[model samples]
Target: MSSAFDDFELKGHKLDNRFVVAPMTRTSADSKGKPTELMGDYYARFAEGGWPLIISEGVYTDRQASQGYVNQPGITDAPQTDAWKQVVERVHKHGAKFIMQLMHAGAQFQHNEYTDTPIAPSEVKPKGEPLALYGESDGWKPPKAMDESDFDAVMQGFVGSVNRAEEAGFDGVELHAANGYLLNEFLSEHFNQRGDQWGGDIGHRLKFVAMVAKACKDAAKGENFIVGIRLGQITVTDPDYQWPEGEDAMIKIVKALKEAGIDYIHTTDTDVSRKPFKGGSNKTLAEIVQEFSDIPLIVNGGIDESNYEHIAAHYPNALLALGKKALANPDMPKRLKDGETIEDLEFAMLQPTATLENEWQWRDEHDKHIEAD
Candidate 1:
């Protein structure tokens, strides 16, 4: 049996505990796509709070259509890559490993500096309107169908970003293939309607993601450089969507990712324990992954102080990645270990927009209001 406080190892990186800070999009970077000083502090806060591993928010990989929101961080140019060094340095000082999550917006796009159009496996729009938390948009725009050149560019973007991540001194890179982003758009049958080899069946749909993963692994400058991916059937806005192929499809997807040299798999959903298989399977997505592969597992979604112990007991070998709970308490690991009362996350902290500066300002005002009473 494994507890959350126990040390764990993923690839060659030895984690201090099974607790991880999940990647969250704060949309808190400079207008030029450089990581700001504030962003460094925002990430370092988690490491200082006792999280062993911190996965950064989705970072655009290319200057062409990869950016999904205004002020989103990018890793395309030298200066942007150089700016990330400070962020990595800050986290490393706390003895925590940081992994940059590389993403392409696809049709879920709200804004992009390089191009007005989003690119995807097909010219499909996302099922729901763009998220108000990230950016404002009436609805999702239909993406341009990707061609051979587009495919090459997407691959190059991921590989180049992985190299930049190495240059920035990151421990690893997680391909943002979940949450209906570009890679995930390819995975979703609703978004990926292409009749070509890149679409149709589970294997074909997974081909692009596999190729990107292999390219990232091959491009890693260090043998110990970790390359992982976040996978989910549901997007941020569209929750009801599941694979038409269901549990078997998920099994094959896990098998394919393992074959593609993915170092680990992070399964996220609205709830990690939910049986979302439309075919009526009793297993959760994380369980399916555990049953199929021996790779390191990081499970996310609705993992909070109340249910963490039970969740940990079930996925004994897996790392529990916390998003909302971590936002509520950056020092969750320390607090949990100390048996301190952890506060719940209030939506007011992210009111109007989700940004590091905004959160700080909100806290100041909130604390002041409390004192005034």
Candidate 2:
């Protein structure tokens, strides 16, 4: 009998299972943006622990301009590419596939790092002030309005990252168009006020994103490469905000992504299980996405043992991506396979290193002692 554990094909590869490690930022790389030994070991454990596919943390594609936080990895240069090779090799050794998430933080990043002002679809400030956890709060500023020249450069940067990811041995790439980053900024009405070809209605707003997706897809042609995109309902900067045109715009965006040849659409939002606010369908967000696209929709956020079964039932090809839960337990799927209950973890336990609470706390005290000595 076929089970939920049965293999499913995604982007030319038969994924070993529907369980995926959702992309989460770990700001632990060097300033120059090289992945550390710890980073490789960190990801390989999830693969070794049995996840079929892993979406890596958001990796900046435009070197300086795209960086959102300090110590996060970059994919714009040879060193960054070379560093990722170690990660790919380790994941492949465990029989799991890896995909790099290409991102540009846009106005949500540091202005000091780039010296030049950060570029966005339009000049607008983010909704809230930045957080200290991201290393610098002042990084969140109104971005300079992007011109035709900046658009050309940004497009090339995304396409370059895809080429570099393939060269670095990754099986695929996912564009981070969600979470109020550059792409998400364009999708929001409060941010993108441009009246040009790149902005206006739902379709026009998605034009630049489509360009990047198509360029990356074209670059990966004939290669054993998978190209996908991630979408979000609300911006990280403004949770209360809705899309400029609401559900219709969202439905249109999904269709546009599918037409651009994206193999899958990974959605990060309020919750996959939440009911529609003002839609004709009584179905949840996951069902709505499935309704709009023929491809797989990776539903994330608020997915745990409690609701995963019900949420997964909405889409025939839904991939359940675990974020905080995955950080706490690499063997999440194994537990599910054995029918074990998921843990309720403290937020402090899932960052920097997802180790035991006492161990992490002890290490901090030890470091202070060493400093005094």
Candidate 3:
């Protein structure tokens, strides 16, 4: 029987354990999208507490319009890279590997505040309104479709961001291909209706991601940096999201990434126990997807201490990513490893709208409002 703390190798780097601190956007960075001292402290806490692999929050590439939220970190500039280096150093000092998630918001952006237009594969409007980068309003306008030149520029931006991540001392990079970001928009038929090489069939739709992965691998020549891509069935717009084409699209995309030399596949599903299809009783989404491909898989979303043993036993090769649980209890992995009772796990710390300063405050207030009795 293998323990959660057992040593594991992923994408060429040896990890102290199979537990990874999945990427969660705290929005604690400085105004310039640079990591601050507070950010360093925040990440260092997790490393010291005992997370073997820490995937940083989704970071913008180079395109200004790609910035989806205010204060979200960016890896495109030198100062930003320098800021992230401090985070990497702190995580490494505590015996953990850090990976940066390179992302582009694409059609998710609302106004021209970041840029005149948010680029997308087609001129289709996003299903719902996403928050503006700077304000607290609701109505967001649709983005203009991208031309051939614009598409190439975005690809270059992704490539450039990966190079900067390497310079920042990250152990590897995870393309933010999962969430309803640029890559997800391209993958979905409802969003990407282009008639070019980047649209039409599944193969064409997967071109951009493949190009980005290849660029990252080529950029990190001798560094042996682990390159991975995060793919999922959910997007912000399509919350109850499912790939209508079933696993066929996923299989094709994974095959392309494998050919591009990507080392791992990070699959995100809101609930791991739920079957992917309606009536067909089959393996979970993560299991089914992993079966189709031959790369290491990191299963995230809906993981808790109670299910850690069961998950580890069932999916031996998959790494479990704890989001809200990890945020509430930074020592979760450590507690599990020590076989300590975890019934007091903080639940309110996972509030999506609460800030770091207000998270604990809100939790305290809520606790006071609700007595143990």
Candidate 4:
């Protein structure tokens, strides 16, 4: 029986084990998108607890407009880059690898910092405004249809950000192309309704994604800078949403990423067991996608001991990512290593908004409030 404790290697980076700490949004950064010191301690805790790779919460690439919420972190400038070094050092201190996840909210942005409208691949108005965090709500608005310059920024911003990440001492960078964000907007037919070269069919939809991949890959010039993308089976806009080109589209996308010299691909969904779209083989989505490349593959969402055991029994090559389970117990990986079991998931334990001062105890307090409801 294959277990989640097995070692794995990808692109010359040797992981301690298959436990991947999946990213989770914690509204704890300062106004300028620099992670607070407490955030560093938060991440280091995971490493201390024994996770192999810690993929951070989405960090915007642009200074002002790249945010989905007011408190999200950014890596576009010196202060932000300099600030992340502490996080990297802390994670590495505990013998775990760290990766920065670059994300652009596009039309889903819900902050008032920037005066210009958000940018997207098309002018299609987002169906619902992103819910406000705390009391902030003035930035909710539709996005501007991206022009050539916008696409250039999409490519260049990612390039610059990943370079910043590399400079900050992160082991790698993961592009957040999932969850109906800017990248997914371009990739989904339900969100993007443009007729230009950047949209329409699956090939065209992938153009921007491919451009970003090349830029990120190029920016990873020296060092074993790992560059990968996190994608999902369905768009966040709708549970039923899928690639416009059908299920096999990801196979093509994977080939393109491999050709671009990407190091890995990460996948997730509401449940990893969901059969998202019509595809070639009857294998699980992760199985079919992994068949496309020898690059390391990561599958996340609802992963616990039982899920990991089942998946490991079948797809022994896939890495398991733990999200809520990790949150419920930061020492989860270590516990499993010690021959313990995962605790029951407590969804109410997550804080809708977290701050450095409060994040440490937010779960306990919130669990009291939500569980009572």
What overall lDDT goes with each candidate model?
0.89, 0.77, 0.76, 0.77
Best by TM-score: 1
Candidate 4 residues lying further than 4 Å off, grouped into runs, are 132-140, 279-281, 352-358, 363-373
Q: What does candidate 1's lDDT look like per residue over 232-316, in tens digits?
A: 9999889988988999888988998889889999999999899988879999999998999998899999999888888888998
- TM-scores of all models? 0.97, 0.90, 0.90, 0.91
List model 4 lDDT by residue over 60-158, tens digit each: 887545777767888888999999998899889888899899998887777635545788877765665455433256634767888877777767788
Minimal lDDT window, size 10, model 3: 364-373
Q: Deviation in angstroms for 154 in model 1?
A: 0.5
Query: After superposition, which runs of candidate 2 have C-alpha atoms over 4 Å from their true positions?
Result: 1-3, 276-283, 350-373
Residue 48 alpha-carbon offset, candidate 1, angstroms: 0.6
- Which is the winner by TM-score between candidate 2 and candidate 4? 4
Return the TM-score for candidate 1, rounded to 2 decimals. 0.97
Steric clash pairs (candidate 1): none
- For residue 252, give model 2's deviation from the true position in Å: 1.5
